[model samples]
Target: MTADEVFDDIVDDLAGRGVSAGKMFGARAIMLDGKAICCLKRAEFGVKLGAGSAAHEKALALPEAVLFDPAGKGRPFKDWVALPASQSEHWPTLAQAAVQAAH
Candidate 1:
């Protein structure tokens, strides 16, 4: 499936589980309790899994994963990771972790 399709599936699944769809940085995002859990920018899946958490470390270790910097500046969001579509297989799992972290 294409990146957009994969992202849509993730959003649909999360929404079924009570997560709400919203916007973040002008990109599509999934929210929980008014807080963003994750966002999709181009083919990147930016997720908030909490800095220094096991899930965050694991995600960063993935190929092409990096700290999310929406503005393209040196500063990056400590709790967010930008995962490329090449790592899409891990998207669903990490997305769930983001939701759990938000709780």
Candidate 2:
């Protein structure tokens, strides 16, 4: 699926979760309350899990996940993870974790 399609699927999955869609960093983002749980940055999705949290550590351990470092080789958002397109199947679960973390 295309990036837009993937993002749509994610938003659809979160339909009853009380999250909302809005613009963030010039991209589409899923928000909980006023905080961003995840955001679509180009073709990739960035999930927030809070720095040093167990969920953050676990996500980082996944082979398909990486630290969300949009600024290239610089200080990365240690809590956020860039979910791999190859691992789209895991997005729902990761997205849930991000939502919970955002709360």
Candidate 3:
């Protein structure tokens, strides 16, 4: 699926569980309990799955995943996972984990 398709799927799936979609930093973001769990920024997908958690470590283990730092070459956000297109298939699952981790 394309980026738009992926974003739609995530938004739809999350909505079923009471999460909503909104704009964050000019990108599409999944909002749960008023918090933004995941977002699509410039073709990259980002998830706030909590730093040091198993899910966070698992995401970082993927070659397509990295630390989310909007500004280049800086200390990355500790609780965010930046995912590349290569890991598209895992988006849904990771997005879910991010939501669960948020609580």
Candidate 4:
């Protein structure tokens, strides 16, 4: 999928689950009770959790969040990190971290 499609899918997932969300820097940003959960970039199909957001760390611990190389650097974080394709179900946890960083 294109980066934009990936980003939109994430935002759609969150919104589908009833999480408040928005957009910034052309990235899909989730908002929770007036807070942001994460920032998703369409070009890179990347999701950058807000500063101090623990979603990335938490996701790292799960097997679902495999480190993918999008930049051909063999580095997971260089270009983009693969979030669980099942992120829709993981929205609560992810969004919580986003809210934390947003606040």
Q: Rate the local accuracy (lDDT) of all candidates.
A: 0.90, 0.81, 0.86, 0.50
TM-score of each: 0.94, 0.87, 0.92, 0.41
Q: Order of all candidates by TM-score, from best down to worst?
A: 1, 3, 2, 4
Model 3, runs deviating above 4 Å: none
The candidate, 2 or 3, that scores higher on lDDT is: 3
Which 10 consecutive residues of model 1 have the lowest summed lDDT? 9-18
4-89 per-residue lDDT for model 1 (tens digits): 88888888888867798899999888889888889888888999999999999999999999999877778889999998889999
Clashing pairs in 3: none
Task: Tell me, by TM-score, which candidate is best.
Answer: 1
lDDT of 1 at 23: 91
lDDT of 3 at 2: 90
lDDT by residue for model 4 over 1-103, one digit each (tens)? 5444555665665674556657645546666665444555423323445323356666556655544344446665522235644554454455445434444
Superposed on all Cα atoms, the candidates' RMSDs to the truth, in angstroms, are 1.0, 1.6, 1.3, 6.3
lDDT of 3 by residue, 1-103 (tens): 8987998998888887878988777888899888888888888888898999999999999987899875556878899999887788888999999878877
lDDT of 2: 0.81
- Candidate 1: segments with Cα more than 4 A from true spot: none
